[model samples]
Target: MSVKPQSASAPFAGPFALGTLAAADGPAFPALVDSEEQVLDLRTALDDPALTMRDLLERWPAVLPRLRALVADPGAVRRPLADFRVLAPVEPRQVFQSGANYRQHVIDLHVAHRAPDDERPEEERRAEAAEIMDRRAAEDLPYVFIGLPSAITGPYDDVTLPAWAKKPDWELELAVVIGRPAYQVSAEEALEYVAGYTIANDLTDRATVFRRDMPQIGTDWLRSKNAPGFTPLGPWIVPTESVTDTGDLRLTLKLNGEVMQDESTKDMIFDVARMVSYASQSTQLLPGDLVLTGSPAGNGMHWGRLLRDGDVMDASITGLGAQRTRCLAEES
Candidate 1:
């Protein structure tokens, strides 16, 4: 991923002084690049001896000062953001994805939304549904699951099919990128430590997802959810400051420009604030960590379908931007 030379005049425009390119002018990044055309390898850039996450945050008051100077010259050092291959914004030691955290997601669960009548008493059904609703409320415990970090891929990367899988699905979700170490933080204090948010597609295999062919109650969720390139994020991280309200934002998914799934962040079962707080209750969330906030309704499998080869899926949020990925057939 070679860097492109910065231009004299700004290439894109928006807030945060993009220098030659601004936020609005670029593609909406779920992992880091807005689109393949404007991809950037931020990981390689950070790996440079001159920069580190610590330096970007606190060690140096001005992490981009040197880079800023470099960009200003345009002719010196490497190229601009338009030149590199986009990469996942975070390299987390572990990834966690919330399940059925949105109201519509619950409705989409269909039969799984509840147990058989004989298994659950009337009281139990009501209580369970109440509990589920509480969690989905903007003000309750946010359920989360550990996701396979290796499943992550860049914005424009391809989503591959898994062997023995009858169905493959795409879930458009709003992902939280952790900025710093946080432990047992309160909901009110959670957003302060957030680095930003990006669109994430929580791709899954249908068979393993429901443990349909498995013998045991617990299926290999990691294997089902963490296929290669299962997670597609970026096109750059939208700074937390730029978003006015994570809850009120509209989220939509399109297959080759046709809207497939569309909803608002306000429908989330657990809002970002509660999610951050609940996640930090036991473990420390480190910088460069990612939290996939679950998907809304309208997944492929819900309609007895799956993503086929050459299918292009693009997910977008109101202010955060968009991430597009092409679905490809698995090589035997």
Candidate 2:
């Protein structure tokens, strides 16, 4: 799909910085920028703004650095984005996620797959995720999974489950938006290339994620995430430049204001810098490709839980906006 353009004439009403944008005036993505928030819509903001994504890095070198400063200052973009209706910050060319980058998550997932009839030592269970851990010793390789580009949705959007879904669980994760084309990049140079960060809930249905019955079709991980409104995101992408410490950001998941998951990204064993450099070896990341850094330890499946109709879930990251959604039953 072709990327859209931003209207030159006040795309939004309130204070806004250079990169921030409002929705396309109607039933577009909701307004992320209001009198009280700092937001940007990479899709809308990049729209023919006299500069392209590639242009910002070279021809208009000052612009990229300005964006970094604005996001960090929060208050800097106020005048340009005060009234803009916020939209998803980026229009990714590809979307991916790490499988066991965080130690706690590795532990939780192994526990979930435990056999009811047989017993294995916890060390044995962790070995599965461990065998490949060393691959990341040099970079983000060895522990990631490809997510369907179509599976991703804008932040603040609703998540719809398949009618046959018996389990809908949330995996709280932090996602990174790539800023440019990259291949064989070094970890030392990774952070400089990231556009920003956002909160993501990798919704899944384990019963269908890896089913053998679907031989006529294919592995069902896509089906698990491809349900309409499945991936809830938004608030907005906090430009990576603004975040000096991606390692320590706090993440939380709540249902009706009650905390369900609370942890810090600092626990990530692989971290963002390595993931980007490693992913670049094979996939060329273009502007807007999202890399969902793995989730932390707390998830519903750990407790035999799942989302039911009318359940409102909200996920928040330290600097990113909170995403809210209500799970609804699939249509009969």
Candidate 3:
């Protein structure tokens, strides 16, 4: 099947991004999205109507050059992005999330959740937290936890705020998409396994984060972070080559048009390479898996303003696209 050439200009000049989009009359399919909000149906472009994002990643070495060629010289019919509903870029079989990996975010959490009976000055507490962070950076490994892929949602999807969640919050993160299989890989070689980068808003219910009922059991990530639609995954995935500097990318999240979290990836205690390498030590990383780098400082808890019904979150990572998610009250 040959793709018909188009007279309209190409959507982008260089490296392209990938996404999942569905027209009103069809099922969701993998697509190539351009910077100008245009889309080329990947299934149609590649002449394989059954192609998925996972299929491309699994065979990335061969597919990469073809994708680059397709981007440069169009052979497919292009359509306006508004003609379809965007979905989560990829449906990973396993999702690994790094927690407390941002130095300042950890300190912010410490300050925000100070012991009620403690009488220390705020500045003194902050200093202590900072010192602890420094020590942890030098001595600790990345704190990784498993996240259910069932929680994944589209970039523009409306997330239902669970009735029982009193302190729902946003955590915008830079998500690394794995292309090559990796097992116990070194940090230096970890990036070679990366397929691309995308955005994820790791919504959490602060009230459920710590199991107060059983303090000894500690944090309950499954209950606090894995609600359906809690993770707004992507607008698109920008290939690794497109991102020049992963270490310095800026992450910005705006709540109701006001900037809530704005920080750089440089603040991460464990960078992307380290996070991916650490996770690979325990389990083999496969194509289409996601490695979520921890969120930076400035969550709702720190601002004393948790999520409520009708709140809109606009999250973006440098080089990767942005995602706008709205919050709705769960129906009784």
Best by TM-score: 3
Scored by CA lDDT, what does every candidate get? 0.65, 0.64, 0.87
Q: What are the per-residue Cα lDDT tens digits for candidate 2 across 87-188?
A: 455555677777677776776665666789748777777776565454444454446667776666655555667787788888888888776678889989
**TM-score of every model?**
0.75, 0.75, 0.93
Following a full C-alpha superposition, what root-mean-square deviation does model 3 have from the true structure? Answer: 4.8
Off by over 4 Å in 3: 1-14, 115-118
Give the per-residue lDDT of model 3 (tens digit) for 102-156: 8888997888789999899999999999999999888988899999999999888
Regions of model 2 farther than 4 Å from truth = 1-62, 66-85, 112-140, 214-219
Root mean square deviation (Cα) for candidate 2: 6.7
Candidate 1 clashes: the total is: 18
Expressed as tens digits, the lDDT of each residue in 1-332 for candidate 1 is 11111222122212332111223344322212221133332334444534333234332224435434433443433334544344555556757789877785675463345645557655666566657676548345677888877888866667777666667888898888777788999989999878667778988887776565666776567768888788886545566766778888777888877788888888787789888888899898877677888888788866666788878887777766566788877778
lDDT assessment of candidate 3: 0.87
